[model samples]
Target: MNGQPFQTPVEYLKGVGTARAEVLKKELGVKTLGDLLQHFPFRHIDRTRFYKIKDVQDDLPYVQVIARVTRKEILGEKHTKRLVAQVQDDTGVMELVWFQGIKWVEKNLTAGKAYILFGKPGSFNGKAQMSHPEFDLYGSEAAQRKGNLTLQPVYSSTEKLKQFTLDSKGIQKLVVGLLDQFAREITENLPLYIVNKFKLMARADAYRNFHFPEDANKLAEARHRLKFEELFLLQLKLLKNKVLHTQKFKGAIFDKVGPFFNEFYAHKLPFELTNAQKRVLKEIRQDTQRGVQMNRLLQGDVGSGKTVVALMSMLIAIDNGFQTCIMAPTEILASQHYQTIKSLVGDGFIEVALLTGSVKTKDRKIIHQKLENGELKILIGTHALIEDKVQYQNLGMVVIDEQHRFGVEQRSKLWRKNVIPPHVLVMTATPIPRTLAMTLYGDLDVSVIDELPAGRKPIKTVHLYESSRLRMFGLMKEEIAKGRQIYIVYPLIQESEKLDLKNLMDGFETISREFPLPQYRISVVYGKIKAEEKEYEMQRFVRGETQIMVATTVIEVGVNVPNASVMIIENAERFGLSQLHQLRGRVGRGAEQSYCILMSKDKLSADGRIRLNTMVKTNNGFEIAETDLQLRGPGNIEGTQQSGLLDLKVSDLTTDQELLMLCRKCVEDIFAVDPQLAAPEHQVLNMAFQDKNAGLSWNKIS
Candidate 1:
């Protein structure tokens, strides 16, 4: 690391002294010469050709041209300087106006002489004119292009910094001068086989071309190579972390389910478990008993019966005399899970306690005492479960519902609660794309329930334009007449805004005024409302006290009202595909034929159209999730990369799904043959890994 050149401050560069270096540092965060080399361009403008004045549209941007300055006129006095220079081409003559800097323009634009001018062409008073045009004498593409970067790298800076004369050109000048004296070629970090196979440019060549390219093609190639390396290194780091964690942690052994599972299976409750549920449970059982801590991700579409499998696993832990704690994102979900498990397990004195932030003072104290004493075996709650005070005597397993809703730190806190971290199981009803699943949960062993429960009905999805509002209402009335409750959900403009959409409120008012049933109550719930109020509204809908519920996406994740058969998503184009699927999952929980009406405005983008079409085509959340990944790519799912899973650049986990399979195969093959990458051919692999994990590495390379 110390051997590399241009690692020193920019002030030490050949052309850049203290003054310019201070401006560079303050403006672009480029204190070192290395920083300038890494500052890649946002985009580039092509000035390879000059357009004719006649050919240039009024709306198009103008370029430098050799034109005669026909006439010069001043329109304003001293302080308010206004001047115009009419420059003529063979085809036409356009007015070049300079409102503020007229004196400088007049001196340069001598009448009857050719001068180059650049600006945007605009029509004013039926004549083409440009404001404060950039002009130069005796200039052409070949001559002016030498010092300027071929790609024209745009550095990010603030307004104040720009005022200090630390612009892109200044940064470029400093970089070029430093590189001449200090730049030394570094060893290529990729294996020779990979470089040849991918036809990637050499690492040093890529770095040079990325900063000061001779052609657009070279610049593009350089960018692609760099982006690929960045993503690969990040992935390598994540995968390595997972490997280290698995090596260090050993989980509780639950190998023999002979007496416990056998007795439970003998009675078999009333109905048999689905093949999918059985398969997932077996996977979890195998993983848990393997001695290594089971960090498995359970992904299932809604109605796929993920909860049953989770419960069965908890039962296995409980039967083995180990306590289990299930954490939910919401109190309502916690309460619901507690009810389902209590009835299903029915093991008297097993001690299942419900703990949430909303629990009363005395009740909370009692729950806390019970948890600390190890009397509460399967304690379920929201984040309050990990609230410092809640202690488990023998916490064997931890199940997290809606895994994305919780922070990474929050999850880690729960794992370290016990001496030996509990075997972690993250459950999500929102099915993730397979490639994403690997990258995101590369650290965890993943088990999925792809098959839906046998008796569960598939929700029928339909897309409708806003023009069909009257027809949609008619269809809703028909569904309502059948004694089925309807949920009309409004999409929020922004996730944070409590009252962006009037649709939720308007829909509530409409139901109360127009569609009110004497016995069929209507309830409204949104993000603005208190959590207790939200729960109350959900409870009413659940207990069948409220026949219709008008709400926003607040009910997207945990609200489970099976009786609600109709889901009308207003302005569906505004919502993402995964979100729409989750909201649709809310309905179809019951037996009656469920339908989701996606009411989108006619004005929809191509991606928007695809999203709506994908929803209509399938009820499978995994399929929709895959489509969503393809459409949106993997920047951030559920907004702002909450999962911290695939923060990839060039590697599209969605589109590069097949390529990832190949990469995984390669990883397996390499690890199988040479676990430590110590082989002769793997020298470059070591280099790549070192570059990728530079920040985390403490090992010295000798």
Candidate 2:
């Protein structure tokens, strides 16, 4: 194992005990010696500047000062006690306070002694204060540094880790110890040619300098090398998986579009296929015809007619003596899809049924039987489709709607339902940026249906503050006068769920007062409402029985009502851009002109303003998604939280577009020639591609 390179457990390290290692593992996911080494510092502090106490401002993040302690005391009762010390620079004196570890701090603080004090500055009762400041005796190692030579790495540490003396300084010591012992053990993982071409720092030196850099330039180089290496490893894994999958898996070939497809395209088709939809259908049909299993991701903005493309693909499967299923993340969406497909196909065109958690036991058994006997040609459902008892006959393909909601394991379960895994067509309404799409779904071929259906008009979006509630009411009443429905949604954040529910109720009350219930039927829905109740309320709106629906973000994913021409999102600033776009998509489905009114409070953050502005600015989900990625970053993007692929240390998907593209191209170039990386020069690259995430059933996040 090359002297057990990065695999050794942290407990075996010189200074780490079992307790400390456990804390490290729990808090930092640092199970192995390698994890510890790769735990790059969050930031490197340049401890070269000293400021006068008089110059300290509360707005400053941190300030360092050369000061002498003039007074020190412990105050308050035992439980509420704190250690407070006054330190004086030549300009002025500032109070330093420590809430915890007061005894140890009080013991160390000495009056009439000089110290190097550093911490965030704040004002308490118009006097300067520094809380829990880090200090060292003046002229000690920490206080004697000058310029970049004084750069100190600060690792992230949890309170639990701190209890075991495994805070940033403690973690640093362990890393330093490990580096001294095993720095020579890290061999170059990259091919020598590629390394020379990129002029990347050696793997060993990069690891060392990542934790403890020599200078700003070396630190920068080390950071770039590490980021490049991480992206390279990820791309290598994805590209290799693609090659191996193509070679090993066989797909069901639906070579002909037969009666079901022909008949539907001839008479049952609801609308003329947009060019984008037709192009996507062609791509899917081509994938299914190939001997290799098709793994394609279909990206479309809302109302882009992707469902028709998916249905046509399914019809082809039926004609080829195969079965297909569509899995939506929500029951409401699944039901809507069932209704849409049912209406599109007309009566008895093909056998179809809805399966969900609420399905009756007897009906579920019947549906299961139909699926097993190949009587059900198409099944539309939620995650209930993936249950162990739910079997499919000749399951040739599976289409996952809002594919991000399902974990990789669950998706793979559906893929493996057949003797040979079924072809997978993953569809998402949320737009992904080009670079992120490549990184997240690197193994799947992607097709984007960028064009919306004809006769659909872009929903006019406008921003309004709370002061304009009366104006919103006027707009709502005007839309209702035209026999149209309206949707009023509130933010439902977990931390402030009570406030959110209160807001929703208050909105309902306000609307109820404006247009009394006898004159206007209004329905309310939120996460706290019973599932059946929520469904009833949503179905009322869907059926045009309710002129206005008061709800929370639960309506974001599903609940289609084309007649609902107006959507008012209260506290619109609370939502991310993708969410705002999705909410806006609920309207604009009907041919009639639609409107989305963003209602936010006066105090909007810069990003909040950007989000609301973007909604008003464009209907393009891709553009909205790019803006979202830039504002919040990749890690916080909709479905990427659980994706270990985004556990990037230095590389940012938003800003590292150039680097990501370069890495992808380099990997693709190698794969095109080697296919298996069999050459001598490529062996190091192959060897370095260790599956650290092995033994995981849900290996792929996509």
Per-residue alpha-carbon lDDT of candidate 2 for residues 15-113, written as tens digits (9 for 90 to 100): 997988888999998998878887879998866667898899999878888899999988999788888898888898799999998878878778999
- Compared with the true structure, the alpha-carbon lDDT of candidate 1 equals 0.74
lDDT of each residue in 206-295, candidate 1, tens digit only: 777777776889987887676555544544555555666777898888866755456656664445788888888889988888788888
Clashing residue pairs in candidate 1 (N, C-alpha, C atoms within 3 angstroms): none
Model 2 global lDDT (CA atoms, 0 to 1): 0.87
Model 2 off-target regions past 4 Å? 1-5, 17-19, 47-150, 159-167, 360-373, 387-389, 494-498, 527-536, 691-702
Clash counts for the predictions, in order? 0, 0
Per-candidate TM equals: 0.82, 0.84
**Model 2 CA lDDT for position 355:** 100
- Output the number of the TM-score-best candidate: 2
Cα error, residue 365 of model 1, in Å, equals 6.8
